[model samples]
Target: MTTAPVIGPEERLPLGAAEADPRTATRRRYLMCEPRYFTVSYSINPWMDPSAPVSTDVALRQWHELKATYERLGHVVETIEPAAGLPDMVFAANSGTVIGGRVLGSRFRAVERAAEADHYRRWFVERGYRDVVMPESINEAEGDFAWTGEVLLAGTGFRTDPGAHAEAQEVLGVPVVSLRLVDPRYYHLDTALMVLTEADPTTGRRAQIAYYRDAFSLGSQRVLRHLFPDAVIASDVDAACLGLNGVSDGYNVVLPREANRLATELTARGYNPVMVDISELRKSGGGPKCCTMELRD
Candidate 1:
């Protein structure tokens, strides 16, 4: 059985932001989910990864428009300082864990990535999230984590380690299902899996994952199987054009403006979708999901 981590109810949205009509607001709120505080990183040359960077210029435009889309959505965006002499810091969103009202900051696996966690910590603390724990023994990255109404699953052997998993589980008083990660380019779980749309207690698996279905070895499959025994596998055509990484809210998805077919399908399904041209950012092997941090879940 996978280790089960119990999650607590998320607190009400922070008080300082200006109030808006919830009815007209584009920001979608999960009934039991809200991200109290969040941070984001910009892109640099990302061609180091072979799978990414097929189209560089188109991806960058989309990355900028992604920022604008979120700003229009009312998420309080916090920017991190550029790491000195880096090719890409866009994946820095995965540096910590928020569980049971406590935020645990972690050490990063990549040497170039270590500074990002500290930046996240300051931002979280400023927002007054209590019970924050600075990780000492292990490295933890967001790619290793998946949240469900019932538990938080953290993976090992990828960017995050088993030591970090155990620490988070104990601090949050929830069972954390730990599994070994598949290696070589599914470096972050987000590359392989992401919840494109999420309701209060349920989440939609985006078609983007189809791009990586053949990559995982054995154990990670067991981890996925444990949770999504009946998950509907998405199709390839839907996966590539869907801007699956750019999903926001349970009802809305942010996508590249060029994805007409997928956008048409989403609108037909009752989603209020938004599109930004991120061709330049994609050149570095990232998509909409790589740029913005979802603050209100």
Candidate 2:
């Protein structure tokens, strides 16, 4: 029942020059699924409304633009075939959390997404990933698990079970810091927080992140502040636009176009903000980060 111990404030090091120095972009490999079957046929989250109209064509176009943006920046982008009935398959990040070539597969809380876990696990196995595990506890993979290069920041209370935090730590061999989400709108961890710069022990670079503080419990907020003293705090307006649901390669940050204020703040912090219009996909409570699954190797 116990998870990894949360790092105390006394152990926290000062994050110097997080906003003063220019950020560096590290090339990354990401897995994304085409939105060929993208639609809001069911309501699993607060954002999804079955009564609303959906346009698969718009979703596909927006998805393509996002994929091209990644390639344009020299990041490797891979795709998985979208299943016909699985509309949310376009959100590849929920598939799994891959780190150091090992995959911790997802066990979705909702029955609608339960089948997605198998498909993602199959991809990992087929592509020669040897250490792929399907957890017994309910977890939504990267949807609730975000790697900060030092520890795994796991979320619970909406889509992921707290038990999954310990499971991930045991399987990934990384310390897990559990954060309790308080807002139903920001159900998944990705929606409320993003890693801007991963901790690099070799280079002595501290991890930098951006988050909506109100989305988390008070204790979790304190934990985050201790870990990342220089973390960017997003405003309510930008957070509502899913601004924190972004993909960052240290320097370049890809986020939703509606998050104009956040984009400005990222620029002030020496990070280039690349905005993309994913209004169509947002209907399903997803953004650039949701559609992307980092294949850390």
Highest-scoring model, lDDT: 2
In terms of TM-score, which candidate is strongest? 2
Query: Which residue ranges in model 2 land beyond 4 Å of their true spot?
Result: 1-20
Model 2 clash number: 0
Across 26-109, the per-residue lDDT of candidate 1 in tens digits comes to 353211111112122332222244443344334434444555555555544555544444434554446565655677776876
**Cα RMSD to the true fold for all candidates:** 10.3, 7.6
> Model 1, stretches more than 4 Å misplaced?
1-61, 81-83, 137-140, 197-212, 230-244, 255-273
Compute each candidate's TM-score over C-alphas.
0.64, 0.93
Q: Per-residue alpha-carbon lDDT of model 2 for 166-240, expressed as tens digits?
A: 999999999999999999999999999999989999978889999999999999999999999988999999999
